[model samples]
Structure formats: structure tokens, C-alpha cells
Target: MAIWVCRAGKKAVYVEEFLKQEKIFCTWDGFDYDLNLYDDKEKLKEKIRKEKKDAEPTAINTWAAQLMCLKEKMQNGDIVLTPNENSKSYNIGIIIGVYEYKSEVPEHFRHGRQVRWLPDIIFRDKMPQYMIYSLGAYRTIFNLKYENEFVELLAKLGIPI
Candidate 1:
């Protein structure tokens, strides 16, 4: 029962129905979403109504497809963007790595020193992690711990996801 932010103007009339219908076509990222109300349990609960029985699976597929599509683009280092309907706001981020790793710091260095080239890269577990265009100057690396932020980044891209 995720609360979907909807325009509070004329479009509010069709929120749930529109979501039910659009789930068949695209990922439904709320537009003009009121972030302040996002965490308001009672408020959001009041705004989000259950979809018709059949629309439920469609919604789940919509979610999975959204995740899969974003995952694919992420494998290619693409960012995902969810543009606001008014075109004034967006959510952006990228996924930069798979399986986390230890620093590989040697016994001597674990306490202080770090070797220049001691880390290892595993191929099978690798996912084409990404860094946002904004971070290009900073050199996005595969080992960054920026919080599955990259996934949010995939949403900001023009890709289908």
C-alpha cells in the first residue's frame, strides 16, 4: 500500500484509477509528490486506496519491470530520473557496486597504512555500478558506499525504466 503522490489540482480526481491504468504502461513515479506528507501514516493511508483486484498484479509487474529495467540500465552505468509533472523537480542517483568488500588492508596497514594497488575485483559478482554525471569530475569508483543511491539515479535517466 504505497502512497502515491498526486497533483492536488484537477488531476486528483483520477489518482487511483489513473495509477491502475498506467501501471499497464509505465512505472508510476508520483509527480508533484508532497514529500512532507510521504511519511504521514494517516495522511498517506487516507490518500492511497486499494486498486481493483485485477489491477494488483499489474501493479506488481509494473514494479518488477521497473526494477528490472533500471537494473539493466545500471549495468550500463545509466542514471534514472523521475521528472515532476510541473518539470521543476526530480529524484536522481546511481548504483555503483555489488557484493561489498573489506579494504583488503594488510595486517601492518590495517592500523594505519594503505597500499596503492591492493584491492581485488571479482567478475562474476560485478554489476555495472554507476556514478552520476555530476560526480564525473570526482571519478566514481566501483567500491563507493553511497547507499544504493545509484538505483535512485537510474530513475533520473531518459531510459524506459
Candidate 2:
């Protein structure tokens, strides 16, 4: 299964509440419509660019692609790492459902992907240097492909690799 890192918010502001409430992982692009209208990734990106008139090309591409992946590529059983602000640690989760739009939630978190968050925590200070570097990326969402790193994390959490 593919592994992914999902940020809680720009500065991890929602980490504690979301985790405590068992809320799903989500993002804000101010997109309130269906994302599946355009089958082509590029076309969808162009649409997003128009919707976000002031966004730079790089931001548009990154946000649109990752948002699209939340609906299209990310699947059930895929791993998710979400940082917790309160503990300064990462919470592991498994995607458990497809994309959803919840109007009841806050505007920035309406688009969501269900996740079965694990109870185990991986503290930031305890992570390996390379894994720390990988998590240091500024992107909102990204693949975490270093098997050895996950192995180490799982080991520390007492979950067999």
C-alpha cells in the first residue's frame, strides 16, 4: 500500500481537535463542487487555476494535484501520517473510505477522506534524521516511500513491521 503524509493545517492548528474528535483528514482549496468533472489531471488543474485567480502556478499545481489524489488515487488501506500539535508527534492512520464532502464541518475542512487513526504516536524528536527530513517538506500532502523509515517508526510504536 502507498504511504502518505497529510498535514493537519498550515501550522497544525486543528491537529488536536480533529484527532480528539475522530474527524477525517481534509483540505481547503475553496472548492465547493465535484472534482470529478474533468477526467484529465491537467484540465482539472486549469479549472482550479481559474478558480484560484491569484494563486501561482506552482501552488495551483501542488494543491490541485494533491487534492485530486485525495479523491482519485488515495485508497482504502493506504497509510496516512498526521502530525499532532499537542504532543509534537505523528499519528498514524489508515484511509478507510473514499472522498466525501461534509457541509456541516468548517469551510476549510469540508472535503474529507475517512481515516481510522491509530492510537500509537511517533514523537518528532524520536524520528530518524532521514525520516525527519522527508516529513519536513512544505507540501500539504506527499508520498512517504521510505520503507526503512516506516519500519523504524512502527518498531518504536511496538507494531511489527
Candidate 3:
């Protein structure tokens, strides 16, 4: 399974909410429609530019790519790693459901996927330097570059990989 790093929110603002709800979400306010409806990232980008006229070209591109990754690239059974700044720990889980538009939730959190979290929490202090570096990515969502090493580390920790 592919592994991904998905942040709850800047500074882990939505960490507790995500853990409580058993889901992972990304915020792109006003674009609440199902991402599956879009034929490709370019279409989504066009829509974003149309709706958010003030957004910069770079921001628009980033949002479109990230949203597409969340909706299309990610799949059921993929491993998800979410960092919790409050606890200085990383929460691991498996994506158990497909992309969904949860209009019932707050506007920023409308896009999400259900997750089944593992009971264990890996503290930052205990992680390797490479892992720390990789997880320090600026984007909201990204695939792990060192997937095999990460899986090996998890196996060593007695976590089911």
C-alpha cells in the first residue's frame, strides 16, 4: 500500500477533531462539491480559479494538485501518517473509505476520507532524522519518499505494516 502524510491543519488545529471523527480532511473553502465529479486536475484548477478569483496562480495550482491527490491518488487501505504538534507525536492510520463531501461539517472541512487509526502513537523525539526531514514537508498532503524504510521502521516497532 502507498503511504502518505496528511496534516490535520496548520499547527494541528484539527488533530483532535480528526482523531475523534476517525477521518482526515483538507480545507479549500467554498469548493464543497465531490472531487470525483472533476475529470482531471486541470478541470479542478479551472473551477478553483473561477470560484476563488483572488487566488494566485501558484496557490491555485497547489490547491488543485493537493485536492486531486486527496480525492484520486489516495485509495482504500493506503497508510496515512498525521502529525500532532500538541503531543509531538505522529498518528498512523489506514484510509478506510473514499473521498466525500461532508457539507454537514464546517466549510473548511467539507472534503474528507474516513480513516481507521492505529492505537500506537510515534513520538517525534523517537523518530529518525530522515523521517523527521521527510515529514517536515510544507504541503498539506504528500507521498512518503522513503516508503520502504518507513515500512521497515514500523515493522521494527511491532506495528502492522
Candidate 4:
């Protein structure tokens, strides 16, 4: 299963709230369009480029790539790690459904994917240094592909692999 690191909010203002609610995760609020509407990531990127003309190429790419992840790459069994800013812990969850566009949510968080937040929380200090580095990436969404490292993490949390 793939692992994804998602921040609850840019400033982490909604980490606890999100964990409490156990809803979906959203990113790139500026796009404003429902990412679920597009099937092709390239097409989405093109649209982003046209709409956000002044945005840097890197910014546009990051947004499109992450939107694509939410739309397609993340599967039902995939894990998600959303760091808890109030503590040195992560709010872990498993994706349970496909992409969803909730217009009722605040404008910044319209594109989402349902997640079943795991009951246990993992503290950063308990994880290995290498895994910690991977989790420290600045990107909003990424593939955490270190198999052994993840195994270690799950084991530490008493979660069966």
C-alpha cells in the first residue's frame, strides 16, 4: 500500500479539527475547481496553467501533481499521514473511497477523499531518522515508498503489517 503525507492546513490550524472529524483531506485551495471533474492529470495541469497564469511553473506542477494523487493514485487501502502540529505526532488514516467534491465545505477544501483515521497516533520521536526525513518533505502529498521503514513504523505502533 502507498503512504501519503498530507498537512491538515498550511499553518496547521485544522489538524486537530480534521482528526476529530475524520473526514477527507484537501489541498491547493487556490485552484478553486473540483479536481474530480478531470480524468487526465495533464489536462488538469493545462487548465491550472491557463487559470493561474502568474503562478510559477513549480507551483502549478505541484498543485496538479497533488490533485492527481487525490483523484487517482491514492487507493482505498493507502495510508495517509497528517502531522499534528499541537504535538510531535501524526494523525494516520486509510483512504476508504474515491475522490469527492464537497461544495458545502469551505472554499479552500472542496476537493477531497474520504479517510478512516486510525485510532492510534504515532509520535515523531518514535520513528527512525530516515523515515523522519521522508516525512519532513515540504510537499503536501508524496509517495512514502520505503517499505522497510513503514514496516518499522507500523510495528512500533503495534499495527500488524
Which stretch of 10 consecutive residues in model 2 shows the poorest summed lDDT? 20-29
* Span of 10 residues, lowest total lDDT, candidate 1: 109-118
Q: After superposition, how far is residue 88 of candidate 2 from its true place, in Å?
A: 3.1
Please give, for residues 53-114, the per-residue lDDT of candidate 2 as tens digits. 99899988887788777778888988888876643688888888887777777776777777
Question: The CA-based lDDT of model 2 is what?
Answer: 0.75
The reply for model 3, stretches above 4 Å from the true place, is none
Order the candidate numbers by TM-score, best to worst.
3, 4, 2, 1
Candidate 4 lDDT, tens digit per residue, 25-113?
67555667777678797889899999999989898888889888888898998888888774388877888888888777777567777
TM-score of 4: 0.89
Off by over 4 Å in 4: none
* Model 3 steric clash pairs: none
**Between candidates 2 and 4, which one is better according to lDDT?**
4
In model 1, which regions exceed 4 Å deviation?
1-55, 82-86, 91-95, 98-161
Model 3, 1-161: lDDT tens per residue? 88898998878888888899999999545786878789899989998999899999999998898898899899999999998875378899999999888778798689999999999877877778888888888898888888888888888888884
- How badly does each model clash, as a count of residue pairs? 13, 0, 0, 0
Each model's C-alpha lDDT?
Answer: 0.27, 0.75, 0.86, 0.78
